[model samples]
Target: MYKSLLVTGVCAGLLAGPAFAQPYGYDDGNDRPEYARVIRTQPVYQSVRVDEPRQECWDEPVSYADPRYQNNVTAGGLIGAIAGGVIGNQFGGGAGRVAATALGAVVGANVGAGAAAANTPYVAHEGYEQRCRVVPNSHVEDRVIGYDVTYRYGGRSYTTRLPYDPGDHIAVDVDVQPRAY
Candidate 1:
């Protein structure tokens, strides 16, 4: 009985390994990018007050930082295939079982692909905000002189101005980034 239990555990591990693993890559820390966009030219709002030095928020590059979780495509595929095969094989018997297993794998692959595609990319919009600060790369002054503000949301990038001077910290609304797995 103990040996059978051990075998079952091993088989389960092999079959369920993918489910236990994570399926996406996302930032773990909730912090602003290392760099911020400095206001270069103004189309509206005229000149920015230098005295109101506020921290600028800028979108960091994709690789600027790593994600919290790594995409487990392999694991997801394996899990889907196993689950699909088991479910598909239930109705079929003998020769039919083999056919069912094959069908299950195909269905599983599709399901896995669909699941991966469901994962969304980054997003920015109104209502939602992203807090940001000055990047270390800035060599201008001790305080933020200005920021190149172009807030984008719902597929629209709207250039705007800072209502208040950015201090040591500031909160800029950002769209929720989708998970990538």
Candidate 2:
């Protein structure tokens, strides 16, 4: 009887050993999976600035007058009048001298006026001046490209970087195991 009992115990141990070695929730059991919902999806980004420099050029005109012209007209008139008067005074005698003096003065005055008008100085000149100013041109550019995902699983919320956007829901795996003490 002791041999039969020992043989039965050994056979039972061998049969159960394979059963214990197999994973749980297999063979006769089924696994239930919990799925999470994608509550929201938002895009994340960083601001970047870019600058492009451009140069613009143009020409402007400037003008100026000669200073010598202003004084020359008056000086020429005075010199001409003095010369005319001296020449006229050298001719005539007596009563004729008096008449000649009057005529000379008149002639001198006329010559002076004519010379002044003829010598009147006026000149027009054209010149060009270059001017330039820098105008800063700027604009904003969007350099942000990313995504933030919010998911709900087992009555709890979780956030992570989702490479692809989960349409409506996400699948979450939950496993149960017996603890050894």
Residues 1-181, candidate 1: write the lDDT tens digits: 9999999999999999988874232234666533233333333334433444457776543332113122444455677888888888887789999999899988896787566545633233334345588644323234444454554333444554664444333344444576999
Candidate 1 is scored at a TM of 0.27
| Candidate 1 wrong stretches, greater than 4 Å | 1-70, 120-181
lDDT of 2 by residue, 16-71 (tens): 99777854323334456556789998877666666666666678876666556545
RMSD of each: 44.9, 16.2
In order of appearance, the predictions have TM-scores of: 0.27, 0.31
Error of 2 at 9 (Å): 23
Q: Which window of ten consecutive residues has the lowest lDDT sum in model 2?
A: 22-31
C-alpha lDDT values of all predictions: 0.57, 0.69
Instruction: Specify the highest-TM-score model's number.
Output: 2
In model 2, where do residues sit more than 4 Å from their true spots? 1-35, 55-142, 163-166, 169-181
